[model samples]
Target: MDFSVRTVRADEWERARDIRLAALQDPAAPIAFLETYEGASAQPDSFWRERTEGGSESGGGRVRQFVAETSDGRWVGTVSVLVERPSDEVRFGAPAKVDQTHLVGVFVRPEARGTGVIDALFRAAVDWSWTLPEPAIQRVRLYVHEDNARAAAFYRRFGFVATGETVAMPGDESAFEIEYELPRPEAGA
Candidate 1:
């Protein structure tokens, strides 16, 4: 169960694609992710390549993707953070009201779920968010489908609190995705 967590490299597109497809196959995919397996699978290699590169280290500071890889080189988990500036177009939910990062594309293999890989991935993501220069990240936020209790529980355990904001789930107006946030820690704390 030994694994290391690190930002994904620009050249790791195939590995990124594989892990993302696997996540879309997980039973929780219906609630955990906005992308469908069918949709993702239909994308061409070029699409994946561009998407992966945009989230990798070469993507500049706007986005970052972190992966947990076993000693044998199997990527088992991933989380992506997208920097959101107040003037940036919103990717989901409401437009950013402050400088922040949105956590998305979270996944951990079933076998790696309880091995602390998730915690490590999240730590790297949030820690990286706080380190972004200029404007300063005021918070790290994510949206969870209301029906996804397991994910909500874990977010709460990780110190994210519900922001009293709800947005209609895309393509399903009746359902809601609740916003959760962890504010930046007080300076010198």
Candidate 2:
């Protein structure tokens, strides 16, 4: 399938909501995402609007959501990045000790698995993270549920390594999420 990955626009909030709802329905949603389908689907239109706006291409460099859209306009995958700064309050897990990007909200439709759509989406997201102005991001990181082998394998193949850090799942203390990191490439290499 032919697809192009690009940062979502602020006006495409409805599309963003639709894709998120679809993601929450995926089998891995329970461990892969922090929210449930029921919880997210219950949100009002304004909530989605604000979410998309905050993650849109013009979100003042705080966040960016990349979407993989097919030739016919269907969205098949998405990945979002949230910029983390040392002085900024932590949103999840722990406070940032240095400038970094947190990868989150990753989802690719079931049918699109192994189709390279994910690779395309990550290219857009990682490229965006590296291009930020002064205080360039030192790395990009994400948390994967310890039991999510599929996701962990993919992250490893994509060059992310475990950082020996783990955090208890927000609402489920019995399980933990492990941290993975991909340090920034050296200058000119």
Candidate 3:
């Protein structure tokens, strides 16, 4: 509750990389993220810089990353949204059937959990998605590992309903990830 949520800046790549590395080490990382801590940490500084730059405010309208920073300037949470157009190639499970934004790389420090940081981060991400100009985004979606009950619960509480779509988790065809989405709200409602 003491933190403020806002889009990330290109210059803050180092901070972004640090928080992400922390997230990848969380116990839930296996189910919550497609990449492993080892894989991410092994990435060079250049990779982190490019990745952060691509999602920063100056990173063209294709993607945006929001972070929750405390009054002291520590970033405790983050959520990135990737704008997907019907004509664009798919990045994960499926191709975009409509103008939509895929929410990814969601994370909140363990100490920051249950303190409203996640909610604030999500609100910022979703609000930004809805505000995109031209071929407006029609929906916001995310995939959760089938066994990630905690994440699914939060997504449901946040108004994202399960779309009943499932795809094999990458690198592990035996496991599945379910899709959940929040359709654009009606005007004034």
TM-score of every prediction relative to native: 0.98, 0.98, 0.98
Off by over 4 Å in 2: none
Per-residue lDDT tens digits for candidate 2, residues 1-189, read 889998899999999999999999998999999999999999999999899989986778699999999999999999999999999998888779989999999999998999999888877888889999979899999999999999999999898999999999988999999999999999999
Question: Across residues 72-184, which tens digit of lDDT does each residue of candidate 3 receive?
Answer: 99999999999999999999878899999999999999889999999998999999999999799999999999999999999999999999899998888999999999999
| Winner on lDDT (1 vs 3) | 1
Best by TM-score: 1
Rank by lDDT, highest first: 1, 3, 2
The alpha-carbon lDDT assigned to residue 101 of candidate 2 equals 97
lDDT of each: 0.94, 0.93, 0.93
The predicted structure with the larger lDDT, 1 or 2, is: 1
Estimate, for each residue in 32-148, the C-alpha lDDT of model 1 and write its tens digit: 889999999999999888888998888887999999999999998999999999999889988999999999999999999999999999999999999999999999999999999
